[model samples]
Target: MWEVRLAKHLKADLGTDTFDLVQVPTPEPAAGEVLVRTDYLGLSVAYLEMLRADSRLPIPPWEVGQRIGGGAVGTVVRSNSAELAVGDLVRTMAGWCEYSTGPADQYPGLDPDLFPSPVHYLSQGPTAYYGMSEVAKAGAGDVVFVSGAAGGVGSLAGQIATCRGAAKVIGSAGSQAKIDYLVDELGFDAAFDYHDGPVLDHLRELAPEGITVFFDNVGGEQFDAAVEAAAPGARFALCGALATQIGDHEDRFPEPDLTAAAAKGIAVLPFSTYHTPEQVAAWTEHFSTWLSEDRFVFPHTIVEGGLSAAPQALVSLLKGSFKGNVSVRVAS
Candidate 1:
């Protein structure tokens, strides 16, 4: 079996060299345990925060010489308990490894036929659903804005807002192609490229009267812009600060302009998706129903190459080289 371990803390610009790949003997499943084979490994720019030396993320940072952690879906190749069958599909947190032996309860079983593919289960549906639908309360008669809207959670956030009946859902991405994909494919009413002009100008033009809901994924300039463009009594769901946490170490945390927000009476709700069973169940219910009704599109990019490719996949994800949800296909 092969596994990837953190070689050192991440620097400003990221690369595959931050991790080391090595071979390890596959451990045999013990009593009440199962041996699982990696099938799909989930990727997210949020992993950048977890790789930092002094990470402020709710979860602990990945330690040097230890296997990295992320989401994954796999199949049981050997089972020693009645909880899971040999071919049962399960979701696990034992990432960056080709195979793992763990207690049957550690890897919860998932319905293989519930989604179009296993990759759909890899999306950040819980975070997106919670932030947009619950925190922001986006619904009809509201103009919604999502920053970094082309990335994993942001992409789903925009679509979830639309699914919840937001009057108009707007997004900001890094490229025109993403903008087109957001509006044309994801059913967003409008989208803009943050690189083209001042985000404030773009937001003001997109939502002339002012945005009523902001699902913030990137915090730097976009956050400031949203504060200025937010209408009175608006709502903001602060999901992440990808832009701030990416570059120079000194700029990892940026403060929001609360003075403006206070004057506008905006409800700024900062939240973390703990991915509790309740959260996962809510997202799966709505996502499954929405997909069956043909009201949603699962925008995703499947990266092929097994376990060794996982590190580079994160690099490409943060560099904006991929669109929507990204996952490494470790096996068929």
Candidate 2:
């Protein structure tokens, strides 16, 4: 077995020099433990940002030779716990490894029938569910705007808003193809390419009446634009800030001018999965129902070469070079 580990803390650019693919002896299950054979690994922008020396996340800086942690779905090849059996599908935070052995409590069993593709649990399910329903409180007849609308969470957020009965859903993406995807496939009322014009201008053109709800994924100029175009008493869900993830620590994300927000009685709420475990179970059940009913659509960009490709895949995602959820296949 092999695992991908950090070779060194990243600088401005990340590459092979920042990672090491090392062979390791296959791990064995211990008492109350399970040995999982990894099938797929989910990449997250938050985890990528945490790998930097001066990360904005509230965690200690990553050290060299440490196993990169994110999300992984696999099968339990060996289980010493009576509660689990061989061949059980499971999800864990075991990261970029072909196989992992950990306490059974660390690897939760997932229903293959409900989650046929376990990656969806990481991609479109939990985060999108909470951000829209719980944090943003999107409702019928509300006009919603989603920034970074082509990426995994944003894409799902838009679709979820539509399903939640938003009067109109507007999206902003980095490319024309993504804009087309949002409008044509995801049922977005309108979408724009952020590169084509100033973000505020694009928002003004796409949503002249102003949006009642804002789902913010990219927090730079897009955030400013959304604030400028927000309706009276509008709600803003502050999600990930992709701009700050790529920029140096000294580079601050653009703050929305509060004068307009205050005048309009707008509310801005920042949320994260870390503070909302109760929402996870509720949203997961809802997401599974939505998936079965075909009320939700999730698109992912899969990178081949298994664990070896993970580092670069994450780099591409942080650089905004890929669309939708990014995942790596570790085994069949």
Candidate 3:
């Protein structure tokens, strides 16, 4: 078996040297435990931020030569629990490894008939569903704006807003191709390339009347623009600070001038997938239904080389080299 370990706390940009691939003897499952043969691994900005020395996540600080934590989808090659059987697909937080062993209680079984693929639960599906439908409460006649709209969660957020009956959906991305993808492929009502000029100007031009809901992913300048452009009684879901993740800053994100947001009576809600089992279940059902009906579009980029490729894959995703959701194929 092979596993990826944090070589050291990252002081600069992430690269292949940040992690080390090492061999380890495979372990057998114990009582109430299962051995998973990893098939796919999910990468996100959160995972990259965790490698930093100043990570604010509740989890203990990362140490040298420790297995990095992440989400992965695999099969139960060996099982000791009554709830699981051999060949069952499951999702786990144990990632960047060829094989993983954990309590059966920890691995949530997935039905192929419903999910079809394990990567569906990785980042885009549940995050988008919960952020847009539950946290943001996007509804009919609402004008919605999603920052980082070309990325995994943002791409899905825009489409989910449309599925929820939002009157107009606006998106901000880094490039013209992404803008075209958002408007032409994902059904965003309007899309803009933030790099073309100041984000505030772009937002005002695209959403002159103001936006009712903002699904924020790339904080900093875009966040300030969204706050400045927020309509009265608007709602905002603070999903991710992608700009901060890649920037050379110790602060989590840039502070937005909230005078306009306060005057407008807007509600800003910070959301996390952790400790949200009820919301997870609800959104999972909703996502499954929408997916079955073909009412949502999910675009993903798959990188090869299994566990050894995860570091570069994550770097590519954070550098905006890959559009859409990113996943590493560990096996067939």
Q: TM-score of predicted model 3?
A: 0.94
Tens digit of per-residue lDDT, candidate 3, span 1-332 = 88999998887778889999999999888898999998989887777668977776666666789888878888999998998999998888786788888799899888777776667777566787788988999999999999999998898889889999999999999888888888888889999888788888988888888899999998888888888887889999989887876455556666666777788899988787663677667767877888789887667888898788888888888888887889999875
The prediction achieving the highest TM-score against the true structure is: 1
Task: Report the lDDT of model 3 for residue 7.
Answer: 92
**Lowest lDDT 10-residue stretch of candidate 1:** 246-255
lDDT of each: 0.90, 0.83, 0.84
| Candidate 1 residue 167 C-alpha distance from true site, Å | 0.5
Which regions of candidate 3 are displaced past 4 Å?
246-249
Which has the better lDDT: candidate 2, or candidate 3? 3
Residue-level lDDT tens digits of model 1 in 1-332: 89999999987678899999989999899999999998999988788888888888888999999998898999999999999999999999998898999999999999999999988889899999999888999998889999988889988998888888888889999988998999888888899999898999988888999999999998988998999999999999999888778565567886776988999899999999889999999999999999999998998999988788888888888889998999998875
Question: TM-scores for all candidates?
Answer: 0.98, 0.94, 0.94
Clashes per model (N, Cα, C within 3 A)? 0, 0, 0
Candidate 2 runs further than 4 Å off: 252-256, 275-277
Q: For candidate 2, lDDT tens digit of each residue in 107-213?
A: 87888887667777677557777999998999899999999898888988998898888999999998888888888887899999888879899778878898999
By lDDT, highest first, what's the ranking? 1, 3, 2
After superposition of all CA atoms, the RMSD between model 2 and the true structure is 1.7
